[model samples]
Target: MERYFKRKTQPEILEPSPKSPKNNESSSKQTCVDSMEINSETLQYDPGLCTPILSYHPNVRDQVRRAYLQNKPCQPKTHAFPYTNFGTKPRRFNPAWFTQFPNWLEYSTSQDAAYCLCCYLFKPDIGDQSGGDTFVGVGFKNWKCKKKLEIHVGRPNSSHNSAWRNCEALLNQKQHIETVISKQTDQDRIDYRTRLGASVGVSRILLQQGLPFRGHDESENSLNQGNFLEILRWLRHSNEGIKAVTLENAPENLKLTSPDIQNDISSSISYEIISAITSDINDSLFSILVDESRDKSSKEQMAIVLRFVDKGHVIERFVGIEHVVDTKASSLKLAIDDFFSRHGLSISKLHGQGYDGVSNMQALVAVAKKNSEIGDLFTMVSSVVNIVVASSKRRDILREKHTHVVLEALENNELSSGQGFGDHKRFIAGIAKEGSRYCECNELGQYMQRMRESGWESLFDEVSSFCDKNRIKIPSMDDSFTSGERPNRKAHPITNVHRYRVDLFTDVIDKQLTELNDRFTEKNTKLLLCVACLSPINSFFAFDKEKLMRLAQFYPSDFSEHDLELLKEQLENYIWDMTSNSEFVDLKGISDLAQKMVGTKKDHTYPLVYLLLTLALILPVATASVERVFSAMNIVKNTLRNRMGDLWMNDCLVAYIEKDIFNSIEDEAIMQWFQNMKTRRGQLF
Candidate 1:
């Protein structure tokens, strides 16, 4: 105890002096006095300043504990017993008995009583049981009942034994409460992640298939648990790893399959798919196709599609569906611009446009003058149809004449009796729409080739000989004919039937030749000719080096002096290799050439060439694919799902329309994506 004392200043002691009272004359009075004095080192009751064995602070209490453990309990000297007038004997504390239980038997000189040190420091609040009050509070001063100290420490499960166990644990220090709690938190985080993973896995499947995620009744007794929960339960049932760690096993509030959780997972999957599309587009030139329609609630939504070439394959992805207040062209253009800005796309990439109910070339009579051959043929056809079917009387005469001609031919065995022709008036009326029946550009191309091969003289001879054999009169060029009658004057007429013949025939041939010339503008034709030189078809006989160099001049913005020089060298090498290489022989078109370039690693070597090819391929000639998107929308967002949100609708359309790419995505990859999105309570994959 002395070795543990390290106070800076020595403690001072004081003794009260005794004095006789002035009125007192009794010197023979017997005074009750204490014979044994108490020491200051052992009597203070304040836990912070006194013997630190009782301190709650480990630093101070542990030091005192070690000092006390080094020595036995102290027992001071005592004097003769002070007798009380009560019938009981005053039992003074005995010092010799301290040797029997040296570690617990302690004497407090100030109290003139003995106490158990072990029980004083570690005694639990068991009230008066097991002599708790006797050993610690009003110290046990019963010297005659020395066996009471031994009785207090009774059997193996006694309070004293429990106190001793606490004392032992306090000194060990390894099993702290904080350390156990920290380990528990770590395990909780792991379990939360596992639970979240399982929830995300179930959500991705539902989103991918465009399936409904909820049910009308999702109670525990219901057999159908909805897509989200039922699938989660099935995952738990199939996998032993998460069976005991998810769903019902998880905390109520953290089941991880809540509606909010499902939506969050859906957003994550949609984000990943959008990210993939963005990566594929990656600054490439793209075209936009926009179409508008009224939803179930009559909200006008503009569905936008991106058409671009990705690795030589033409791909169109649904980027977003925006709600527009009106369907004006300017309003639509603004909406398109805003959508493009939101998705990090540039408006300059747009190359073509289409509308559902728009007619740009509506006046075919006006457009016919652009090509004289088409104009002449149109004028003749219009005149003939008007003259033959202008009135009911003329129509009846033409019908009767045709019937007589057919009967005569049938009687001579020159025509089949079962031959029939439908009414011509209805056919002319049905060709009302612009570019409806007569605008076949491929057919025009074929007709131009025939005229060039057979010459105009041969065509005229065939028509003239047919009319002569049918005994139809040919109008003489010198005959006169009335053109029209004026309101107040006689109509003027002209006679040159041969002049009309020469003019009509020559006009048809000249216009056919002009169409071939007017097919593409100078710059466009040069570009097309250059592009054609890269085509792998026509037996690869179209690859010309001169035209390709001319094509480079059109894009002065992209091609520089150095680029042109490099392109020339590369083109020569490319054409030489393509003509001789057996692998190139199988490619039949520019599309196949572009695809082969990617597969054969030529795209990396000839990047610019591949880029040009991709641009040409992606340049939209029609909006047919965009129209298909609207058609898909009609099916997906029908009356039943009319109230679906814009974001949800876009997600469903992306999954439904681009199913080919969606199907290629792995389920495990989607599951992992959901797991990494946020912290949860269970594992998925």
Candidate 2:
């Protein structure tokens, strides 16, 4: 009996050589391939179809045995058992035998015979008892031999009884050594999870609020042991079960309140958020917006944002912030390449790119400086601002004088009092004027052209009125203008009017008009016109079927000829549907229209039109998402936290800027990921 229970010596499994033939006779010699192929899903349940138990690889033999045991024995009691002629007498299997030996009796309909379930799975190779092979391999169909069944269940220590005992022990998992040991380890894992969850919760709160995690002194005796530790302590006190297993009560090595642990938790959370964003993108067409800025430590940091349409709604996600050695184009390209590779993204899918508009303005200003008069005017205005703000006393005096002027204006009713009454009101009024004037790109270009042709007189008059009110002398229009730098007598003379109106004012306006023409070329102007046709304001008043069809032609790669034909029809129906639907009546912009289309499921109804809308939304309008990341970087890596590493700063910034994504993640997920990052002193799962 003891020998039957001894462990068997099995051959080592080896990998099959690649050079081996698929139909080679030696293929049977490879055990690893066979064992890898066997699993619960592939296990045979029909008793007659099962292979010999010892023929299987020893490594997976137990798995196969458990599968068979879990499924129990296959008993086809309803089967019509056939009989063989024995001494001129015909007989068949009796269903009453199943009741007599309920645990081990199994009938295979394929062979029309009876078999033992335990002996098939646990029968030994060395010791052979009478009729053992008959029950295991050859079917026992002797209907005349009623006493053989009792002989098979012979003495208590017989081969059949021993195999039955082994089957029982295998089925009762509570008696296994590993299960008994895991009882204690399971408690340890529960406690570890509780402790780690508390730590992650604290980290999330600090990350969301953009607060620093560490203090000047983190010693236990100190009053402030940093936000991470102090917040964790407060959480511990709030819950009794957590208090009993966290902080001072936890194992010193597994407290998970160290700065490194906090960083790991924060990084895991950021990666999870980025993973979700990429998943939402799902390898579809997307646009990237990039911007770079210097942190408080003077390190050049580049931020990236991904813009894509998801489920008929436009989404912009802040993906990462990388520390580059320089802000040159080449360095930025390399940084972007690395970011794309790490996030499983491809530049081929990028349909658009966005950068700071300040670069274009800076180039325009540089070009405008070519005129000496215009250059001198800009220098004067810049110098004034610099001089006033450079001195604290001067800034205070300027503020006081501005306050007195505003008060006098208010007393005289020159300024109105109400909500948004001062600078905000003026800003809104200016925007209203511009909005009314420049309804489209072509209009803006024409407006600039008109400004160049006739705007100088009004500008000059306003300047003269300001000078007279301040009691400053206005130079005569006929007086000869001279350079301020020690008058060059060799140069040609010019009147004050030409200097102020032509050299300075006219040149400035002409440069602006040239920039406008350069930016809004004929092709770009046409594209903008097509895009404006989809505006949802006032019940999509700008809707134009022909213009939208032209827009579809621009993206030939996305819309085929067949798609275009379908889109034309979709557009005709779409306009009618949107104009009649109250859900889209008061939409403010394209973005609102997009969301409403999704809410009403119109995107699915008019998929081709929705595709055009999605493509329109993918166009990069601004790099504001990237700019927000830089703003978050300043707060996360301020002077006090200047020493924070690049990776740490990036992690904190991602969590802070995309708090919406960060908040959606569960603490258990973050804790599980952190645990798997490295081998810990305690198990988490």
Candidate 3:
């Protein structure tokens, strides 16, 4: 090697020369000498400063000479023979015996053999042992050892020695695939794969790794195994759920999750997280923010969202969504209470309960329990039947009417003389039509029917004797069967037998009524005041007297004094002034915007308008979240869509979206927010 140095072209300058004029001869001589010296100096060449030719330096040269004597190279160097005195001739394939069939060039003796650098470095000598049948390829268990058995997960197959040795290999491959997917730039790369009904570029991963196959056991849930698809799922959710899907831990033999693998993973992991989070939460007291939502099917689905102090302020994680068959306040409260209990939590520990607008079901629940025949009991029983009615299976149970007939027949005796004397049929008919179910109580209906038959003459006597013994008196009432004249002029004969009805149907109407009032009309001045004491909140907040007086003009009543007083209280005190709220301010301005922007008028504030506005404020914030999730399911994880159960869908959504996530993940979420990667290397930048 040779080395030299030179400063890139730079100009030199002239300087005054020092001289003495002592003697003409000496001065002339000195002047000529000075001029000549000055001329020599002008060249200003310094061999010592020729950038030192670092290689030419005395100290370096001696060391270099010594090293050369020893036939050594500096820092790092490579030696190669320049030319060979003689070269051997190459052997040729014989065409005589080969027949020169295709007249093609000779074939190479090498196959496309490449080494997995990562495996070679971390697990040397593992190839020949694991190359399945030969040293040409790697087997599944070459690197696994007996001592590693405890730490290494094996196949369910008990053949301990045959258990896959390449778990680390598989895990490493998964890491690389995730890295590649993370580098993808196309926002819909996942969606594209999903639409084509192809794997999430998983096969590409195997191909990139030069692995012949992914080796998935169809019998074992692929999701359970750390397959590339699962990894892509993890990437999708992790990127969406967490801030990033990173390979920061991959090189360290650590893998993160599919954002919400919490939904599908082992309880041990969830428990560990809960314990970690709980141990860190202040006072070990977990604060909760719970609300209920409905699916497309409208099952009273309760979302158990949690808020607790993590490393910093309160973080709200949607723990999970629980589907409740009943939406009645008590039932809902009970369900929430039970959930808290199960999580080692308590209701009293509950700091807040967030729900949608308090309409019928909740308002009545918020109120005190009412008289058996009045608001409370009616609200309770009616809500029960409404729950049954809401379900298709249970709805069939009450349609038969066997249960309702028996109930109204038995209750007919309880009415005061003339009070509801002719309403038994109406009551039974009412029970028959509503959404309800009495399937479990069919035995009770049969017992009542037997009493109605002519053969059961002594049934009423036995009932009267038991009522006397139990100190329970049936209602005093005229014969409901004879309340009016029939064409035969005959009264219902056995109808006078002080009868009884099942407790279920007897309670459904008032509940629905209470719910209607609470949900639709509770905030209506007159209507709310009407059920003040009957409300779950009771008469705590006072309604404005002047407001009540103003609203009273809307109604016309020829009523009793007690009823009027009750009406006055409800009409005045049940006020939650939302008409002028901020949400409504936008509603008010919509009319103006329409006239200006699109030329329209906003008139009627139908109940639907209010409902939509309330939904916009509350409900959509909860359920509209499905838009993005369903989008992802269609695009990234469609393979599981139809197979998804209602409960599972909730889990998927929870993983797919975070808190206040609906509005956050608009169409722009895919384009503007996350950048998908094409490889782990892209992530390095």
Candidate 4:
């Protein structure tokens, strides 16, 4: 590991408290208390001390009344003698003072002097703070009253306010403490770099340790690995630079010397993200979807999606792309399987599969067959449904009626001789001819033309699913050999790789579907299968297939329409009519092999499923859905283009989808469980 460390430093002591032992400690002192006694040292006579001494004097009603009757001015009590000295010599009549004592004390401007009158009138008694009494109800459900408690406190004054004001300084103290902590950490990191003999920041940590900055890249930063390029990026968004604590705002990339290195960093980041995401997909069965489209440069790209089983299927996320050699099922399957192997996933775990084209449909069904629960395939039931329902949703009443007719026919036991005879043929022919005419419309016309395939789409999906359940294949590679050794190696359709590609190209995109570019992300060639993909053109496949193939991966034989050539000829023909003659169809797809880019090279035709997928990718649905994903990526890895290693970015990207898992998690409970984690090792933690 590249060593990096930081040290912690202790904080400094603060200035001492302001409390003092002596009142006259300061040279500029104001008030000094000497004595209240009637002696030469008496301070009441002094201007400063007289007011306070008078303020503390007790009230004498008789003396005040006597003074009032005598019409005497207010004066100090020096002349008045106590009874022992002179007061008992028959001069005790003092009823005039109370009548002469005027109104309350006046407000004064002086800060130091106090009004004796106001002090007597307003001074609060310390013992008077408690309230008189508090009442409490008593006795079980009865209404008896009882005195319970009393509480009282005086409001804040000058002395109390001094203590309360200390809070104003706390923020500064907290900031200082934080700064000290940060400095200590930086120091430790510096020490770590010195020990490791590596550079630190723009300046070397070793240099701070009294060693010279002595690396070749120390001078030329293309070689320098410290806070260089990061600084440049910071400069790009100048204000955010100082505040950004995120890895994105690091300044090293800013100073990095070369563009190629910058690009390498970028690519490295994306790769790391993709790698991390792929790894998460390895643990369980997942659905796969794919779309095919060509770039402006005419490169064929396969956008893949892996629908993972998170906490809930409704919130499941998709997006796992691979550039394959061709549109052939084998090549597409190879790309998918290779990716799975890279991510450490097993093919045996694959359960469900979906596709927009015939290639993906076949491949996914094949993979589903590997699962015991899938019973040798995902029944073609759903594919058949999507075709009809999707067509039905478009307000195609006759097609909907036809679907119900089949359901109705199945409800009734019959030979189903609904074709061939002239009377019946005329009835069917009129419907077929009517559909052919409706196919001329801009929208539902094409769907009308391939009504049968659209109807079969749902059937193929459902049937395959039914078979995959309770059935599975025994792969050839397993050491256990309980059965006969007469192996059928050629059973895999992938064996004829070239033929698969040719077949796919011919069937898929023979019509208007090839126009599915730059429309939407799900529709986009680069991101079609991504969650944000969208397009104006329709599509037919989204892949869900196993990456690896093994022999004996089957139960007792089950035969469907596919085993015989009759079904293939019928479907292939319908697919051709639907695509080749549709409006907005590309003619170059028909004549030029160069225009048909496949995995590694160009081709003229592909399998029926590819045709279906080509249609699906070009479909106008869910373009915005895929945009949401790429939008997240753009937000995550934007133009300041802060780079994350593939693993970390993948974690972030997947986090958007992992929301379902997170939602189901009782985080508070988990946190409570982990609250003691730090104490697990008795201080090591």
Candidate 5:
């Protein structure tokens, strides 16, 4: 064992001074190594001060490699290299050598030698092809051997060439393994967002138009793969980027075009719209207008609308539809309760309840039916209309006769023409302008009363002239009248003048007056008159503080005694401000005034007054919104799509009825909402 140890010790001892000149070179190399320090930060750019690449700690090696590559080779082209003695001549580093090996050539000031930048950073540990570290470790001091630089580079497979390639790869981060993986992940996320966005955009359009999303056959070979898919294909074809990543181009699992996916996107969009509306409501008092109708599926669907003040403007939004087992009051109440609970609404916030106009019209029709003469007149008129409409020949003959009469009247100058025609059109347009219903009712009643009292002779004259022109015989007013019955001898007789004037003309007018009076009762008319007092027309000329206060008294729950007192004072200030301010001038209607008040921030100034305005606005003028919702239901849940689920149909109706709200919402918002609903196959972020 001692001899084995002695053999290893003897080689180490003999290695020190075997070659005297080589020993001296080794001492200088050792001294050079001792003078250098390797650090990642404050890296030594000078090649002479940099430690050998192989001597660096493994972890620090990469850091040094990157630092050296970034600083590049220290060529020192302008530096004056000191002269050194060769065999028989003086030699020194040449600046022109840098041009020959521009990338790898590096000059060190301390050692007065050249180095290889690429080899120093990445040269392998052991290989004959690696070109012994003359340029890397000891540095190249033999200026006479200028061709050694080319020799160090060697062949394509040489270590130095490999090191150079590695340096290039390090500089280009895109080629790094981590970067490649990250880019793939980022691209997938972007494609997912784009695909989802396209799907949402198509859904929004279909929902707005109340168009069906799916077709009967949706196979790949089918010509029509539903509205959702066909519209998506069209959109993809229109856009290059979208075309590259959606539908057929998308991944099998992440296409986002499945039926389930379309429903999810639609539900999300509906949720966002409801969220926006509720956010606008912000727990403010609101009235509910509900109406029930049977869908094509025969399901009793109840549509609910929210009428409230949003930003001081009266807004009526169709919040949702509910399916009830029956249309009974209890069933409807339960359905409404469930819907409100789900949507975070409180029943206490409901200020009023309104149903569709169908009930009122039915009541009026029933009243008319009770009157024998009125009932018979309506039946005969309806019969005539049906007869005229049911037969094509009769309709054609009627159209031709009417056209002939109109043409004859025009030629005879009995009808208005030219400027007179324009005046008549203006008169009709004026009647169409929006006005208080109560005011219109009163005006109509007064107009009818005037026509009844004094306009009969003019009507009689016109009738006589029309009969004469048409070559029909006219009965004399003084002649006896007889019923055209089977037994004419037994019929009661009356004068023609009394029969036509009293029985026909006066009877019809009196029935119309009674119906009008019954429809607009004294109490209801007074309430409407009070409501109209708040109208912002004629610079609020209709504004009456006492009348508005009286209107407030009608809703005692909304306004307390203290509120009424405050409202009285506020109303005085409100009317003065409205009449004087130019912003309130020329306001088209109550809605316009509400918007203007909110725009001018006056709603914040007079809280009580604004509250009154909201209350007035919330009163359902007509069940137009509810009627429109049921109309949309007929279109969305038609015979073809009658099998749609209740929840799905409601979502479609909400989107279809509130198109303005749907349009205002962004696709990105809807996409984010869908993403957060649950863990999806593809990330939308």
Candidate 6:
């Protein structure tokens, strides 16, 4: 590389120089001769006078000290000073200038010029009236005009003195700008973290409550700042640490309470809740309850719930809802399967399924009564109830007579009053017409036995007593049984009321019993019997190994012969173990047994037994909870929010129904989870 020197500009004269005076006196007045022409390349400026170096250097102190120590007196040989041409005259540097000052003067041997040592070493780059490259860049070597060098040093507080102070400060190195800014940056990061933490704390509360995040007006003048912003403001006002670094103190773009951030917090909270439930379920058997209905948009939606044993209690949790394209059974099944898979649930672990029936059976029963013979029987039973309990007078008389009968029966030891049978007026008004009460074969059989043992004579006497007391008619043995005409277009035979009693009442009761038995067939009977083996009450005697083995035979698709054998052995051992253990002895129901077993860590001991218990326990007659979810749906997805998305609806439902779990979550923990999801401007926790 070639090195080049910055060319210095020379002062220009307005006119040509005057011709040298011819007089000897004029020539004697000038201390130097006129200039002569010389090549510019041969002239060299002092290297030390080029510029004062201010860039960072570890050895700057040594370099400055060396320059000061090397300052020698410049009594250079007069002839050795190079002569350079400025214009027409030639000016030669006179180096015989050491007589004026001895301590601060510096002479460059190469340039044959003199410089001010103090100004060259310590002059600062800033400020006006600097050396202007004279004492520094181009040396001041005009020996005939020596006063210029004295003026270049200037006053004590001049730019030269300031540069001297800077040089002294630079020697310490610790006062550098980079080090100062680095410390400030760390403190800035800490303050930013504190500000972000306050914002995250507010987000958790709003999400857990299912409250809206944004307000209509969030400006400084607004009184209400919405849930997210308002809560943060409240936190700032109440907490000293948060107040110092939040709200206006925080950066605008990094408020950390945007809708996206709120959603992330809510989603993380939901994940934690599901994780807890998942752990509770573990690999245990569970049941499903599903109810499919249409939303406001007429789209089919299936609300699903899980019924399982958690700890010692049977808990039912709302899992989620699924949107189905169609209402067909296959479509619903596919939706359920997909929903389970997404949540890491297995249908193979399902022990039972509960469904909400499509329509109210009472309306269906009314419609069917017009065409079926069983309907005729039901109509007769309804008519009997109407006749007995129609008027206030007849109702009072029936109650009085019922009370008398009950007192007499009790006194004679013919009947014993129980909890539900204590009040005659509280009797089921339409007992014969209710299918549930009538199908209870044991109760029906007991009723039939009482009627037979008491005979029709007592019934007749009682009716005669009521009729005679009320001044009503007493039909004889040959009276017509009906006041209306029969189907055959002839006047029917007038069989006596006694014969009517034997015919109409007997046929109705017998037909009802027969129909009920037919409906409750061997399939249902065996199923109920098998389910009985899982009962934990009555000394757990219902847990018969033989009955359970027979029940396992029905589900060939699920249980093979080997499985059945294993189940039978498990059942025998379970019965013996439960009957012997003090913990199992007092268990009152299957749920109680399940809970006790889990508490004692005995569930794993008899996996098949507990599975059977789960199956039996979930065969509840009603899916009222599933129906209740639909009822809640009508309120949640009202006219205003009818168009809400499926995921949003599910989230709302979860938050609403499982509020206890949501409330149990700690505020700090929720904020921590939200912050972990992504990096944000603010620090939360």
The 0-to-1 C-alpha lDDT of every candidate, in the order given, reads: 0.59, 0.74, 0.33, 0.31, 0.74, 0.58
- Please provide, for model 6 over 47-147, each residue's C-alpha lDDT reduced to its tens digit, 9 standing for 90 to 100: 33222332213233334333232222223332234566766667765544556555456555445566655555565445336456566545666755666
* Better TM-score candidate (4, 5): 5
In the range 100-196, model 2's lDDT, one tens digit per residue, is: 9988877765566778888888877544584746786666889899899999988999888998998877755556665566554778888988888
In angstroms, give how far residue 505 of model 4 lies from its true place. Answer: 30
lDDT of 5 by residue, 562-611 (tens): 99999988888888898989888887667677778889999888888888
lDDT of 3 by residue, 488-558 (tens): 54533534333232222223334434444444433443433332211112222332455434333333332
TM-score of each: 0.47, 0.68, 0.22, 0.23, 0.63, 0.50
Consecutive 10-residue window with the lowest summed lDDT within model 3: 72-81
Candidate 6: C-alpha RMSD after superposition: 35.3
Candidate closest to the true structure, highest TM-score: 2
Q: How does residue 471 of candidate 1 score in lDDT? A: 89
User: Which parts of model 3 have CA positions greater than 4 angstroms off?
Assistant: 1-302, 305-651, 655-684
Using lDDT as the measure, what is the rank order of every candidate, best first? Answer: 5, 2, 1, 6, 3, 4
Assess the local accuracy of residue 399 in candidate 2 as a C-alpha lDDT between 0 and 100. Answer: 93
Determine the backbone clash count of candidate 3.
38
Give the poorly placed runs of model 1, Cα more than 4 Å off: 1-184, 217-226, 233-249, 294-296, 346-530, 544-547, 604-607, 660-685
Instruction: Flag the better candidate by TM-score, 2 or 5.
Output: 2
Instruction: Write the residue-wise lDDT of candidate 1 on 225-249 in tens digits.
Output: 7877788888888887677778779
C-alpha RMSD by candidate, in order: 34.2, 18.0, 34.5, 35.2, 30.3, 35.3
Superior by TM-score: candidate 3 or candidate 6:
6
